[model samples]
Target: MSSPLTLAPATGGQRPRRLLVVLGGALIVATYLFLVTVQPAEIAGGMGSVASLVTLFGFLGGGALLVAGILPMLSTSSLVVMPLGIALNIAIGQIAGSLGMQIYLDAIGTVLVAVLAGPAAGAATGALSNAIWGLFNPFALPFAAGAALIGLLAGLAARYGAFRRVYLAPVAGLVVGAIGGLVAAPVAVFMFGAAGTFGTNAIIAVFRSMGDKLLVAATKQGLLSDSLDKIVVFVVVALIVYALPPRAVRQFPFARTHRVLGGRTGALPAPSPVKAAHGGGSGVA
Candidate 1:
């Protein structure tokens, strides 16, 4: 018995704003790509190895991801990309076994952006920002795909009646995050050097060396505990996104537009008229 929902066409005035937003997003993406691919390799040895050099590149990459997450809040079209980017980066980190510099960068950026904006915007920005960064790293392919999927699923949740009710956002995030984990598990295992003859042994050896005594003890004592930590983190993020205030959420460059129901039909209200130099209407009038 319920009527089918329909979206209204955007008004003419909104076109310029939308165009500017798209252009800005493209520029951000381009700049991020350059930083990820050309800049890092040029400045450092692809991955930062030297102490001071590593720190510098680390700061730069982290700053770029943070900016990407924050910038999208300015426009609705691009706001959701952050979460997608974040989800993708998380998958990549989990899959790689050895968390790279990019993971820290993304984590810091995502947490900061999510705290500032709501979880939805935070998640979107996180996803898109990481996706852009991933373009430069072959290891990121699986994560990027996963991030894209999460973004799409979250958007769908927002569009549906029951899911958009704020309280359900965390549930939405959990479902999406779980799906991301499932998809990334096999890809991660492969990427973690399990693809070749000695890959599994090699990876285990590497883990042994990296983990050392403390890590080994921790792993042996409670693998489930470590996994629970990760799940808790994801759920916390989802809850944060859901609970963020509208005003706070609006601060993000990628903020979603509030859909006003039963407002004036058709287009948005026109801009107020400007007075002429002579006080009366101008030539155009």
Candidate 2:
């Protein structure tokens, strides 16, 4: 069998790269905070409230998400960190609006990053993403926890090699999502108590007020429906990422460095002379 591929040995240069990763992570956190604290209220009040101003901001948020999706591909560490940031925004958005579909997308992104990296990085991304949402919106704490759990579970699945197969992606997401729902249920009961029932009713009422068409849209295309859709989307994204070249995967800035490949001890063993000769002799005379 061929030897495993190995990355170059570490150098002091890693510190600067690490610093960049930290800074990038910090920037993501800040952007999420702004989105959570500022953007939603603006969107709710009406995009036209400030005329073109709010619309401009909405465009900015969309642009940010696109950039974020692309950024994780820039480097190994970034692959993890950038996705963590996206996951945070997704969790907060899900909680704030009960947009289950968005949460699913975030979960997918988390799993992709984790699989490319490893579990600890995945868990960190998951935990931190949910934690940030929790801090921003107390009402979302349960969902935040759920989102984090989904990330963690997805990471675990990836670690065990369960997600390497495209066909298993949706199954893995469904299993992970069910676990997340279980984690969120008790918390919802504890925190919202009967209020959650009332809250759901209130949401239904609001949808009703918007008319049957809107209500149907909300129910069919909203949180619960979106959650299911997200599962499908997550699975698809996982499949696509799985098919990508490792070098392409490595391009993401948030991609995690595999722990096995991170240290000097794990460096690829030098090829034996016989094997090298058989494969292709070294150009050296």
Which numbered prediction scores highest in lDDT against the true structure?
A: 2
Candidate 2: list runs displaced more than 4 Å.
1-104, 142-144, 194-230, 250-285
lDDT of 1 at 194: 21
How many clashing residue pairs appear in each of the predictions shown? Answer: 31, 20
lDDT of 1 by residue, 11-122 (tens): 5543223343344345434433443345433321232233223223332343344344445334553454445545554654565446432112234335334433344444
> Lowest summed lDDT over 10 consecutive residues: which window, candidate 2?
258-267
lDDT of model number 1: 0.40
Segments in model 1 whose C-alpha atoms lie over 4 Å from true places: 1-128, 131-138, 161-170, 194-234, 238-245, 250-285
Taking every candidate in turn, the Cα RMSD to the unseen true structure, in Å, is 16.2, 13.6
TM-score for all predictions? Answer: 0.35, 0.46
User: How high is the lDDT of residue 158 in model 2?
Assistant: 64
Candidate 2: residue 14 lDDT (0-100): 32
Per-residue CA lDDT of model 2 for 1-285, tens digit only, reads 987699766554333234433443444344334433454333323432432332223323332332333333334554535455556446544664574333335455556555555544554455455545556655554344344445546667765655555666667666665555433433333334313434454654566576643223233233443346446745765666656655555443233233211221122345778879799654321
Give the Å shift of residue 135 in candidate 2.
5.0
